[model samples]
Target chain A: MKNHVQWESSLFELIRRTSVDLPCDIEQGLRRACKTEKKSSRARWILEALLENVQKARDNDAPLCQDTGSLIFYFQVPVGFDTNALASATRLAVARATRLGYLRQNTIDSVSGSACATNVAYGAPTFYFEQCARGTVDVRLLMKGGGCENVGKQYSLPAESLGAGRDLEGVRRCVLDAVVSAQGNGCAPGILGVCIGGDRATGYECSKSQFLRKLDDKSPVKILARLEDRLLKESKVLEIGPMGLGGNTALLGLKIGSMSRVPASFFVTVSYMCWAFRRRGAVLTVRGGFKKWLY
Target chain B: MALLKPRRLEYPFTPEQVGSLRAGQFVLVSGLVYTARDRIHKYFFDGGKSPVDLKNAALYHCGPVVIRKDSDWVVRAAGPTTSIREEPYLPRIIKDHGVRVIIGKGSMGKVTEGACKAGGCVYLHAVGGAAQVLAEKVVSVKGLYFGEEFGLAEAMWVLELKDFPAIVAIDSKGHNLLRRVKSASLRMGRKLMKSSDPFIP
Candidate 1:
């Protein structure tokens, strides 16, 4: 258990590196989009500036974006693993990471609006702990920026009107409407996660969970899979393309999740993520000794 | 002799003038324009009193970067903030104050479109995040309507600008370039998504 706790602290340092660090995958995505959407000079310039900013951030060990964002942690723990000491270690690691990462203290007291320079706060590292069948601890850390966070929306619509059961087309419409409402404000060429069915809170949780998935993976559910296809199709038709300067790509990808809903109510929620997808994850193991796998 | 500038540069600009201005176009403005955002809009709409007269004036959608010295305010970075944040109150502000030009980034909603057409005003989009560059164009910091208590980012600081660069996004004829661009791009994106291989197989 002591060994496991030590591994957790090491994982936090790695997460901090990835949070402010510009990973190669995100850089590749931005570059590919820039080449594909060459017609938009302004969009190209914005992307180039962002790319330059990323490099500068890495070189100087500065935050990649000004909004350091709230720290969100998703933990998938083994069912039988002792988890009592994990919280205290995580808090210490977060405080240490804030100093190491050079991340701005963005969390403000809601009432007084005074910023807590240290990242650690009451109930922060906003843990969503899940006991999984898998025999290892997997933690994903996301620095979700405020610009894209402002655009998240959830709504419950009548089930009968759209389709008999949950229609994929109706889900697609809802996602499209969300993107349109966002305009360029969410800083377009953004990504979105949608969850269909479930109550409001659970639906949002499912949507956010989708962010932890690998950028390359596709949706698992067939209905949601088809909805992802349709949403990608319809959203680009919005012309809210890259940075809202108007281009071929408005959204990078649409990931969807689903759960069964009651016949009376159909709830849908969409969580928009900006181009600055600042997140990283890692797995730590102490079976024989401390080992870390950064993702 | 130099050419005479238009004298009656007030609210309800002519349709012809609006059509000429494109997104990213630069124009030298020489007239009265007020400044307001979330706080001031709320103050007037939320039934609070105002010190300045808003009639026949343009309300810039900006919260300026300013420095103060001996009671005088100096403009530092006066770029437009995202306009869509004030979408709910913009139409009412335009109607109530007879605002002519709305300078900000992003596009407005349907209500603003109707208001622009009905009130004969235009929505201009200033380049976002170009604060330091935009501040160079402001010749003087006319006066501030609101205090710094509202936060430097949200307070309404009146500015007198010259040659402020902007593109006419939504014009009096109800034409919005932002929407047009979005629709066109969306059509292209839809086509590309449908094909199994967007590129040649």
Candidate 2:
């Protein structure tokens, strides 16, 4: 609360960790996928390359992917906390992280196509702040690359092409369609974060938020949790494998969340995440000091 | 039904060598590779000239993490980006620059395959997010172009590589490995969706 410089430093550390290190669950998913493929197979080779890259990035303290992706932050704090201060601190941390090579200069002008060297332009680092009763601060970050973002798809229900209706069957079909179309383009052995029953904009936002969850963490809703597992198991049948060369492991995880929607709209939003899957969180103490890292 | 051994490639390679390579083959590429992404491709599509010659060279679709160290630019993470996004501009770039091999993640479309076949160029699929591993293969950052104008990610970075890993996803013979994978998956996907198994909500 008193030392502004220290707070910024703590945020910088969070940003750096999120960029350079691959979380254990994701790394384990890759390792497990590597074992499933045949010896010396293309899928195995690709998995090995990814695992090897993960280690090298951590050991060298380098950004895992050159993209360093879009910096999306979720801040949950107590009602009385100063939100504006935290936002400014985060923006400073992002720019410093870029300069120190933890993050690449990735933001660009939509009008001119020029790069934002500092990655601090308006709407560059997206922040979502909400008040929580926990009386603490939790900042979560997801570095989603452009490649996978380009592959994210949204489907409207009652589609003749898929025979998808306004039900779970429809959601499943839409997800399968998304993965099938993405193939290896979105980077297979990927993860799918889905949102059902939300409006067009909120649908994608909710789906992306699912990436903040651990690979093994099921949704609180029992049906959604079961769907998550079923979707993952079915993805292997697609046989897209890692980077789409074809293998046993098609997807690592699938998470689905839902929001209340108007009767007229039944949108299924699918947010595709590449195997890189860089997501990290930090819990701050009551006095605005770093408490612990939340994977 | 692919070979275990990785075929070694040196950049500025010939048409015959590129033609001989088939889809689904693993390759360890070495030598001069040029990095370019959406902006550079758009530049070329708009008839902008390349400062460095791209004829018969390895064109990597990457926006690498490079920084200055004692006056020399160093590549920290130089993994491939998704290639499909560049499809609109690739055919023209291949025609204009005579680009020998295209390196990136994911599969491209019909026109890219046709252009590769006609131009005798091949598409190489590098591990999508293996930037640090790929950067390790980059022995040196030789030169840069359009750094100021296009920004770091969009600029053309000339890299000297050694034993960089990739696979031949689209060969010069009009064969596309990624496309084949997608089509087969599509059949399975159709069957799965049509199955009787239902998720009881």
Candidate 3:
């Protein structure tokens, strides 16, 4: 038997914090971007208003955005831990959170298109569990919004269009195309996660997983770190600005990761996350107490 | 073109009131606004009558977070959804409802622009992703329709609004701010793509 009660309560708190609180690093990035823009520009004004909204939501303990988004949980556990128990606990916690209004009832039945008020419909609250050498259980949650999700793109490289080849240059073109296409629709000041090589589904998954890294963290690979910096600087030139109004600062952060691929295929997937990037995690001890908080 | 000053207007606006709004201007709307998304729009397209009067009313494109209190419904977070998704049905909705103002984010398409001109309606762009701040303007929920069927997010929420701020993204005169941004950004992207800067394709 597992500690259902304690785990449920802790997961509820995690959901609450993830929905209401803006992570410190992302907040800092917004503040920095706000300073560099023209004082009277729309980008600056939008950032200012957003920072205020963040404060208001936190102070009032209210959800930061109306679209609480699809709740996705990523769990890493010790080899011998029971994955089924953890998944069940997560479902119960999601249900409780929906009832308590910590999260909006976002899950729906795809076929029937009915609102599953419990937010625990089939395949809802997507879970990814993996076994690791560590003894502690680490769970991360990300609230992926629909608008941004709609804008995510995948490119099969070595293409004649845009004169892109199956190279790092091709990846750069693919990501830029996505940012340009999204314009103001995906909500500006977007954070992007780019995966250079993988199959279609796994490529998108890997791209979204890159969002777990802190906004300022540098990629261990020198070339990828350089690409991240370059893309971050170049995306501003698109001038999509905040809310798609004309100004500076189109993107706040860009994370790049790559995986090995078959010689015949070169795939690049780009995942866009809106400014309201709600993501948080915690390490839970067996007793269900928070061992530590992860950004 | 000169920038128009932001205006404040109440519900039941006339064609003249809508004509006065130009793209790039701001507006603060007060009074009652009806909320509907994908499903409710389809409902209207399928010949379903609007539960409430929409004559010269502001139609908001949103799926709000509403919770039922003791007996009343409270809007916890009321932010605008992307407007482009409703492009196929907007022209008809504007014509049928006699809607003067359509509030949403991400400016609609050419069809909507033409409809706004023909129907004498204006597209008001709300701040995207600012649900809590937007919810503050929703004073109260008058009532709700389709909650049991389409779910809370897709239901038609009748809300009483006070000083709801938005920008005139597309005006009755056919000017569109979002279109301008998109074209300008595309041009810039092309220019950047052609450059010899190693990152460019």
Candidate 4:
């Protein structure tokens, strides 16, 4: 109800920015990966092409990828914030963005198999709301492509086939298996977010949530950090470079998170993120105006 | 090995043009092509036919982001989608449509590869997620089919392209560059699991 117009405007900008602009951290990560690839290699060519595409998309104010994938919004708001008003504003912004060509007509009706060009269906633009101690409001947008989403895998523990147990070794094997299976299909040189243990649904949720962390940030859990570093190194050996062209890089980085699970269950979920990695965040005032952007 | 400069191929793409190429070769493709993804493929495979012609034609696995301004349609992002999803329909599509060139991201399965070899067709792997850059090459929207039923991503959109960049992943000689990547990665994965290092946790 408060500053409704401002909310829609700021949210639309955020949606547009998330679609067009490649975050600086992910861009830097790509640059670092590009340098590691030998010049004139197929991998090198692919990476160069990706970087050029990034620049072109940013300069032209175009959507980074045609997929424009799932529009996932995560919000941190003050207590007593108008959740309904903000949700309605976000929906309007998404619809306007779709019409303006910032978003593709991506949402499909499951039952009718119809395209919702407006991109506002029952749960098309998935939103997550959490109240924080601070008074500020913040929303993050992740436009994940379908290609990468399709390759995300969830594994159960004590598998004899992969020689994986209910330990970190099992998790490691599962992640490596996922990377290999995905190959170039999911768009290689992907950033992986791994969740160690949880229920089937929550396992995936925790894994995907790990992507919210910056590419350069380190996991606070020491053991998980070690696993992340280890996987990042092993991935390089796989030679699944940019677009799975067989190069010096296989992964940008790996972030691993663990959850307490019931004694009977152990689930490992791997969320594969392509090089596009289109995500952007904005910090807003209570009055619903943009204060600054967050990577 | 060094990457080769792209081989330039124009419209009216033919089996002879596909025969000249090998796996791992990059090429700049130009000409008119039909865009189809999962739904359109299913429709075609299930005996559905449209006005679009496919004799010696190119098939692009893409779901482009398009916007209509005035009477003209504008393509915003036109990048490749993952190709393997259409594996079941690919062989038949090629055989039935007389499709000479298949363009998409990633590689196809063994069945699709065999179809390419038998059909004298080539699979060109486009840059995945490079939508805007790829769309820049789309000079015009020639036509659209099944927009109402199949929706945007699944509808068949005819596109005229100029110098669209892609690499040959499968060729008429049954050569596949992606297979090498696959085997090597599988080998490396086996080695990682067999390593002496203890689990991090």
For every prediction, compared with the true complex, DockQ reads 0.13, 0.78, 0.58, 0.77
In candidate 3, stretches whose alpha carbon ends up further than 4 angstroms from where it belongs are B1-5
Clashing pairs in 3: none
Candidate 1, residue A255: the lDDT equals 88
What are the per-residue Cα lDDT tens digits for candidate 1 across A196-275?
Answer: 88887889888888877666567776655666776676675566666576665677777888877778878888998777
Q: Write the per-residue lDDT of candidate 4 for residues A1-295, one digit (tens) a residue.
A: 6898999999999999989989998889889988998877888888888889899999989999998889889999998888889999999999999999999989988998888979999988898999988889989888888899999999989878899998888888899899899897878778898998989988988888888999998899888888898889888899878888789777887999989999999999999988899888989998888889998
Every candidate's CA RMSD: 7.9, 1.4, 1.7, 1.3
Model 3, span A4-79: residue lDDT tens:
8888889889999999998999899889989988875666767887888888889878888888899889998888
Relative to the true structure, candidate 1 has a C-alpha RMSD (angstroms) of: 7.9
Sliding window of 10 residues with minimal summed lDDT for model 2 chain A: A1-10
TM-score of 4: 0.98
Residue range B97-186, candidate 3, lDDT tens digits: 888889999857899999999998999988888888889999989888888888888998898899887878899987898899989889
Predicted structure with the largest DockQ when compared to the true one? 2
What is the C-alpha lDDT profile of model 2 across A1-295, one tens digit per residue?
4556777888899889988999999999888888888988888888998998899989999998888889899999988888888888888998999999988888888898777878999897999999999967898999998888999999989777998999998888999899898887777778999999889999999999989889878899998888888888889888889988988787889999999999999999999998989899989875668888897
lDDT of 2 at A218: 85
**How many angstroms is residue A223 displaced in model 4 relative to the true structure, after the best TM-score fit?**
1.4
Q: In model 3, how large is the Cα lDDT of residue A38?
A: 84
